[model samples]
Target: MSAFVHPDEIRSRFSAALSAMYRAEVPQYGELLALVSEVNSRVLKADPTGAERLAAAGELARLSEERHGAIRVGTADELATIARAFAVMGMAPVSYYNLAPAGVPVHSTAFRPVEPAALARNPFRVFCSLLRLELIEDEALRAEAAAALARRDIFTPCARTLIETAETAGGLDEDQADRFVSELLETFRWHAQATVSAQTYERLVAAHRLIADVVSFKGPHINHLTPRTLDIDAAQAAMPERGITPKETIEGPPARACPILLRQTSFKALEEAIAFPSGDAVVAGVHTARFGEIEQRGCALTPTGRALYDTALATRDFAALPDDWTALRRNGLAWFRYRATPQGLAARAETADLEDLIALGHVVAEPITYEDFLPVSAAGIFQSNLGAEARGTAYAVDPAKADFEQALGRLVLDEMALYQAEQDASVAATLKALGLTTATA
Candidate 1:
């Protein structure tokens, strides 16, 4: 019997391989990585305490290795198959996002590790979107796009075999895991040769650039792979200096002393030469889609906290409302992980009063990092890179979670519920470690 390879190990290997492949495919992404590293290093040096805090939280070790990529699939079969492939890496579809409301004709779900320990080990995620062909106003174009998608199979035969093998055996051994990574990497690899003709590609582009992107490609090539940054503001400021033109405005909330949710910024998508089928000759055309993005993650908010955040965000001035960690916790605005202090662990007192413990410095509370994406932020990234056509009124379809889930073949795990569970589990474990029971204390 071979040793069972842990899913986290597999995921780490796959993420590293994917990053290397993407770096080669998009050289700008490699430059972006270097820029982010410089900024992160500077931030750590300037704020030694911040570095220590991240180290204590187990976030520092994974900071340089963290990456989240996005891809757009054209059909339900492609979506379902990719979901299975991601499952082999211990990732599940987590939250449904309807980009239609934001003028993009697609719905998305972020596939990621659900468990806290798994996430801490390797927080690799993929924001996978499935195109909504029904959203095309032109019936003829929609049908044509559907036909184009129907003719293609994104996954390779070997990839499908490996996914099934892993499923049947409960886990992949070392060799199988390496082969699986290599096979699956092909699905996201960029192909400059379009599967559709130039005329067909133009027709799909007329409907929407994103539609063309999804339907015309050989596979769902990774549109962008974002690396996490400690100070996105600094990175954003330094983008132009590094020869990278960033988008006009950062996607999420403005700079805050205590960052709330996730803030993101990205460079403009590059226009690349692609070959399209045209009779006996292949026609070359320009396509813009892939880009480099950076993110700064903040504390996960509770339901009440998220309500407050939504209310504040509704004003369209996310940065205006300044709230610190203390205020956020007092107002029930964020989820936090609790840990017993050395004093508390030594005393082992039975106390039910959390406030007292916190006030006495017997229990330390730290914000749980938000491990997900924001719908509005996601839409902003898509719209910014998709050119002016994606911003037009024609693509504004209603939000449809049910249809998205139907295509996914499974319901997405509620993001808030996951956060709440993490918060509760941490609190419970902290209390138990301190020799206190919730029933008595």
Candidate 2:
């Protein structure tokens, strides 16, 4: 057997390739990346301490390279194949998100690197959504959409071959991995020709714009590729200056000194030309979907803290959730990664008083970066792109997470458990390094 390429390297290469493709397909996305780069540089230059802290935590490098894209599939096979494709690249599905409550007829999950090392290497993520055909009110349109979706195979034969090769053989060699990236890239490539006729397309659009998008295309082209920014507020403001029009409101929690969770803003999706089948002739029309997005990430909150955040989000009163990092840690509202300071290692402190140690410069606690999405925020972005018609609950939705997972061929991993485990491991390692016992520290 040939030597296998590491999944992280494969993922990094794939991310770079995907970014290049998106830039060429959507020129504005390239502009968005440059704008994010500018804002991040400006923020880092103004805050040297923050820059140094980011560098120490191994975040500075990844911040610029990090990019997440979104894609929606029409069938269970497409979703399951996408899951397998990502698995070969060391990514796993995490946190099922029900968007029906937000009026979008889809449940979703984020496919991302699960481990800390792989994440630090390249935290590439894809917000994969599966269209809920049952939510389509028009029975005839729903049946047509399902039949059209069933007829299409999103993955290429080569991609399928490589996925199976990777599974049975344990991993792919360098040549296979390179080929895998290219073959997988084909699955996300944009096609302007619609599979359905103009009349069918009109019906699907009338039913819901998203259904048309998922069913009319040759493949589930990535809708948006988002880059991380140190300052999303600045990025949002700078969009217009860069000849981009951003959404009216940013998604997720509002701006804060110590940013919590994720705050995202995006330019409105572009309305591009599409060609639909019209008997012997092709009919030309317009379709809107792809866009560029930027995000600012902060600490992961504990369940208790998340509840407070939910309340604040519901009531539009953010003050109820304290903005101070220390207060958040003291109140057990957030997860933090602990490290023993040089001074603490020299002293070999026996005390497990984390607060006292922090005050004495013996220990440092850094917030664990949130690695999941907020369901409401995800829906807001999707809804904004699809327009008001997307918010119609005229079609009954059960929000069957189990059905979605059954289609996925596996259960989605719980993001909260992953974050908790990371924090627990960090604390144990930090305490051991400092020669102290963990007594509720």
TM-score of each: 0.97, 0.98
Model 2: colliding residue pairs: none
Top candidate (lDDT): 2
Query: Whole-model lDDT for model 1 versus the true structure?
Result: 0.88
Q: Give the alpha carbon lDDT tens digit for every residue of 340-402 in model 1.
A: 889988885756677788877788778889989998899889989988556664444567888
Overall lDDT per candidate, in order of appearance: 0.88, 0.91
Model 2 C-alpha lDDT per residue in residues 337-406, reported as the tens digit of each score: 8888899899968578888888889889899999889988988888889886676644455668899999
On a 0 to 100 scale, what is the lDDT of residue 403 in model 2? 95
Model 2 off-target regions past 4 Å? Answer: 392-396
Query: In model 1, which runs have C-alpha deviations exceeding 4 angstroms?
Result: 317-322, 394-396, 439-441
Give the number of colliding residue pairs in candidate 1. 2
Instruction: Name the lDDT value of residue 232 in candidate 1.
Output: 95
Clashes of each: 2, 0
Candidate 2's C-alpha lDDT?
0.91
